[model samples]
Target: MSAAPKGNGARAARTRGPVHVIGAGLLGASVGLGLRERGIDVTLEDLSPTTVALAADYGAGRVRTAADPAPAIVIVATPPDVAADAVERALTSFPSAVVTDVTSVKLAPLLELTRRGVDLTNYVGSHPMAGRERGGAIMARADLFVARPWVICRDEATPAEALTLVEGVALDLGGVLIEMTPEEHDRSVGLVSHLPQVVSSLLAARLVPATEQAIGLAGGGLRDTTRIAASDPELWMQILGANREPVVELLDAFGADIAAFADALRDPAQTGAKRRIADLLAAGNRGVGRIPGKHGSSERFTTITVLIDDTPGQLGLLLTELGELGINMEDLRLEHSPGAQIGFAEIAVLPEVAERAITDLVERGWRTL
Candidate 1:
């Protein structure tokens, strides 16, 4: 959280302004940037002077001064462990302002605040399911919340005006709001976000001791699976620790599946071993189908892989030709290997236009894979 001195041009146009962001890190700076661009007054605050300066210099917002008016909402973007402290401070500092937090785990902070006997009527816990592989003001994007799930954990005691103000900020930042209780939000994120980070990091950790040749053989699949392993471990440590109960339960179930699969693979000679393996793999397929986006149901769309030269403007040209052909690309994934002369662009399109998309690309002197 930070305090940047406010500017004069902010308007109460669509919604309210004077949004006090208390942590000028990734989420905090991003919220400031997003709201500032929309003509809303955003003040940046952080314990670190360099962080607040960096975030303000990046045009997130100006510094806050003692003369600044009370904000309509205070967004506490602190780490999970200290989020409750930040929220309590915000509530105390601005008794009339609606305070919210964007920390990953919602329940821990809510429980901590409740246990401390803090006033809860104005506090709304939230988690915006958006981030890059990295953190900091340097990586903050104004569009970070666009089309992402922003979970609002509002209790019955929360007033309508407070909820509206919080939801307004979410919608203004292009977030799709989803309402959940603190417990529901934590449990859901444990299954979807926290568990995946643990899995990805552990999976990537396995490659550390491997030989160079084995590492060289890695491709898109390995990269995709291990990508989040690059996330900030110190931050994740606090997050995973704060929401340990649900995450541990998920890990236990996941570990059991892994052990069962390994056991089945060890004894193909057993009567039902092969069947068990196939069933597990098929179950995996079904599970993947349920994931949103291009990875969703296979029957919903068709994917065409096109080869692209490792040169400037090659990908742009392919995309340009797709537009010229009037082919709507539903989703896209790019895969390139080190020192390779070509890259693969997997384009997802409607099933009806799949054959046409491939034929059109081939006719345009493009290679298809």
Candidate 2:
């Protein structure tokens, strides 16, 4: 695991030889596609031959042959349940190659390898915080990791060269690098990623028993909150199981918060109950405000809602007019009522342009709300 070329110097990096990718799933295929885009040779493998072939046909990489030379690096992108085993096999099969896994939970696989008494000097655990609700190679995209945070977990025993090779791959794929210990990475993802998936799944599960009338009244808030709930349950089960301790602790704390809120609402006439409810809601607002805005900053913007008819090209015409007015929309969301003929477009723009955007839309024979 000698030092790989620095940055994305294409020629220097391309000389590093074939990068082997195991699993040929969404993350693995995406990694291959990205590396190939940088002129690096990539070889792909998966438990299912059909999956590997699909990824190769999609231009992720070529299938490995016996005549293929040894790879410089091997990325284990198998599902969480089999990640440790695949990593172990990769290390043994490609002794000189630096081995890394992109598993969601880091500590579990590391501990498993340690328990098996496997030599981990060539192994470095990493995770790219990017994915889609769907899985498999068909959904893979070359830019999946672009502008996303990729965590590298390194300990004192991790060789510098091994760490550098993994970091280079992350950087080559347009990922922002962050270094963390195994414990820290697990806990961080447990809170930010795993917890949210669990919460969203449970919230959406509640809808299964709801009446059609109740579900028909759903709005953007419900849709946005439950979007990730559509993710594969089998995959999430493995992730949640691997990071059980931290996720359980987080769920307990969240349950307590829910209980307190319920108590306050149930006793509105009690002393300070209204104040308690308000305080809880205010705390939520502050917590949301703490999330990084754009480019990891906390900048705020203003939102303006405009009404559009459900007829074809109406929304496109509105956007065309917006562009003609030189208004840059920071973010946009469209929500429609069931069986209604109209929809609302919630557009986020700089605070200075919000009033003007509303006025311009109104003057142009469009409705604003």
Candidate 3:
């Protein structure tokens, strides 16, 4: 297990009593598992008894009992549809506790609570930007939030002690903390997270009526673009609905961009048509370049593709050889043809070592592309 970061911020807000997690789903279970790793007491609850039991079985935490004292922290990890209700209940149920949530949309729940005239002093909103396409207690992992951004939505009225407690839990679970208001957080995610999910789903939906021949020509670009389209639609419906205003605004802007690109592509003979297309494409390159690398920095690497047999041990042997060569791989991806006996292993390495790594692999009888 990894050690929780030691510092005044983290130390000041150490968990005093059992940390109660409502909704034993992926995020809840992951929180429990991570805290348990740090020897903190965690108690779990869920609408479904089976889910709570399963998470407990997976080492997340045990079910809460009536005899247990009021918790020091309450993490509501329910679905977005019921997130506001859960947060309200948590705040009322544990009046002295610092209540926080892992809901995707921040504004809706906060507004809902305000509409209900619920006291919000003890509540803080948070979103851990880490999840699998698939979710549930079965998919929970202690290190799920490691190196991931965890946004904390705090208002001026929010107490410092409450904020500190929430940040401590996030840091203890290996998340990089970011502070943002509910409005700022919602608008930001509408562009980065929600927009991508919608675009990916729309792109993948096109494949439904595609000819087999056309589908067979798919490559890494198609896979990378549509990967998140496999996410649960029912879950997305709640998220999209909760953050409807911002997402709709984003969709309108993106649609206009798409229309502009289509117009340019359809009339290449027009003045600056080709230039418009190139500029749009170049803008995409710049946007991608801004995405942070492994530890929140913009660094680029070179990728080398090696051809290998489809046999089970072939890929393992190739990786073993690379280790022996003392070459560190930054990333690895595999691509295979449907009926082919060979596949490609794309290995990312530092740009300075790419040539030497390629030469070594080629000398070891590996073919490169």
Query: Going through the candidates in order, what is the number of backbone clashes in each?
Result: 17, 0, 0
Give the lDDT ranking, best first: 3, 2, 1
Show where candidate 2 strays beyond 4 Å: 1-15, 294-337, 342-369
For residue 168, model 3's alpha carbon misses the true position, in angstroms, by 0.7
Q: Write the per-residue lDDT of candidate 3 for residues 1-369, one digit (tens) a residue.
A: 246533222544355558999999899999998888777889999999999999999989999999988899999999999999999899888999999999999999999999999999999899999888899999898878877899999989999999999998998888899999999999999998999999999999999999999999998789979999999999999999999999999999999999999999999999999999999999998998897773322134688899999987999999999999999897788889989999999898878898999999999999999
Q: Identify the leading candidate in terms of TM-score.
A: 3
Tens-place lDDT digits, model 1, residues 208-243: 999998999997689889999999999999999999
lDDT of each: 0.88, 0.89, 0.90
Q: Would you list the rank order by TM-score, best first? A: 3, 1, 2
Tell me how far the alpha carbon of residue 251 in candidate 1 is from the true structure, in angstroms, after superposition. Answer: 0.6
lDDT of 3: 0.90
Q: What is the lDDT of residue 98 in candidate 1?
A: 94
| lDDT, residue 9, candidate 1 | 22
Model 2 lowest lDDT segment of ten: 292-301
Candidate 1, which segments miss by more than 4 Å at Cα? 1-14, 295-336, 343-369
Off by over 4 Å in 3: 1-13, 294-308, 313-335, 344-369
Candidates 2 and 3, the one with greater TM-score: 3
Output the lDDT of residue 360, model 2. Answer: 92
